[model samples]
Target: MPGPLLRHVDALVGVGVLVWNLTASQFGELSQQLDQGLDRARDFVTANLPITDAQLDKLVKQTRDGLSGSAPDPVGGARTAAEVFGSILLALVLLFFLLKDGRSMWRWVLRRMTGPNRELTAAAGRAGWRTLGAYSRGTMVVAAIDAIGIGLALVLLRVPLALPLALITFLGGFVPIIGATVAGTIAVLVALAANGPTTALLVLAAVIAVQQIEGNLLEPLVMKRQVQLHPAVILVVVTAGTLVAGIAGAFVSVPIAAVAWRILDTVQRHRAADSA
Candidate 1:
């Protein structure tokens, strides 16, 4: 097997083992905590809202039955696994070819264009490439900061599975806004289950503070230099990408938008120069 493929396989196995151990040790405890929390919530709702105890009980029972009836199919699980494996294989192949032939490929593309258009295309391509590189580096820095900040809070709170949760946060950071939110929610829930509501609230506060700093300070400082984008534009692009292509789309949307913007800016400048 190729080195990249072997590395990917190793990573997958490591993650699987980590997840298995976490589930094996903590599943029962988490479930118990969840049940207790739900009971407390039910009581509070019954006292505050216009619902009767009997109605709340019926609603809870129906929800549980529905969840139980919706257990995942083994065949579907196997199929999804196969699809994931195939995607990894395809990505590896593409990466290898791109690494090996990128310059030649770019030259080939340039050869297909003519005169000023060729120069414009080359300039735009270079700008887009630079934007992508900047985005990747800046994102990694931001992600690392997020993971470290939250992971430290988890450790201070004595949360279980802190390492694995931190790893998830780091990976999730790649997906931008949605990714961080989901990862933080998981961390908060784990804190609630293992510790209590107070710990959970602290965890929530930590997550929010880290995310806000990353969004307002870190990202603007790191990304604005090369990949200038408004927060509203980023949100819109992320939402549209999610609607169109789910998680994969969300992961890629921001970089794609940034690169596109850089390329358009380059083209416009070239056109203006010619006109002048």
Candidate 2:
């Protein structure tokens, strides 16, 4: 097999193993953190939306009755709000580095494209940089879009911890086959805990609908131009990552593609040079 292809296959297998182990061991922790955050979220939602007019009237009466002396109702619980904001900040920081320093980062990789076949090195560098950059930016956009859309859904549904849930969605969107599912599951579980089983089920259905839209429509339309790996390859890599290092392995697959691509391009260049 070709160098690049073999590397990709190896990575896929490794990542699949990682993710599976992580899911089995850590899903409970994710669920737990989600539940803890939901408490604040529930209060935030309930306080914002009192179902009945009498509830609305009560709020006005309380405010008029000198409730201004008390602390205002927070939008989310401390931990939940922290989770939401932290994720957004983390993603934005990643975006900043990707957009701003991508070329510089690739220049380091360019150094490896050296020796007698300098032209080949340059060519591969160009291709590698372009391919990887596109993937990075495209994935970021997909994550952002997913987060916003689902956040709005949660808010409208009056689900607690909308922002935190949205953050999870954004991060989860990065995972190929299972990222969104894991993230969406958190939202559903929260809905179950904070609201009821029916509400959780409905939330799960909404997540499924959105993911279908993203997979069938957005991924092909958006990421296709950026990332050249086939959907089958992507799925395999994710599964492999999950199996190997769990979530961490799955997250590393796409990033490693650039390296895998570079190695392939190098081998291709050598073959052409030899033929020449």
Q: Which parts of model 2 are misplaced by more than 4 Å?
A: 1-116, 239-247, 262-276
lDDT of 1 by residue, 86-161 (tens): 9879988987787667889999999999988899999999999999999988998898899899999999999876
Query: Which residue ranges in model 1 land beyond 4 Å of their true spot?
Result: 1-81
Top model number, lDDT: 1
Top TM-score prediction, candidate number: 1
Query: Over all chains combined, what TM-score does candidate 2 have?
Result: 0.56
The global Cα lDDT (0 to 1) of model 1 is: 0.84
At residue 27, candidate 2 shows an lDDT of 55
Give candidates' CA RMSD values in order: 4.8, 16.9
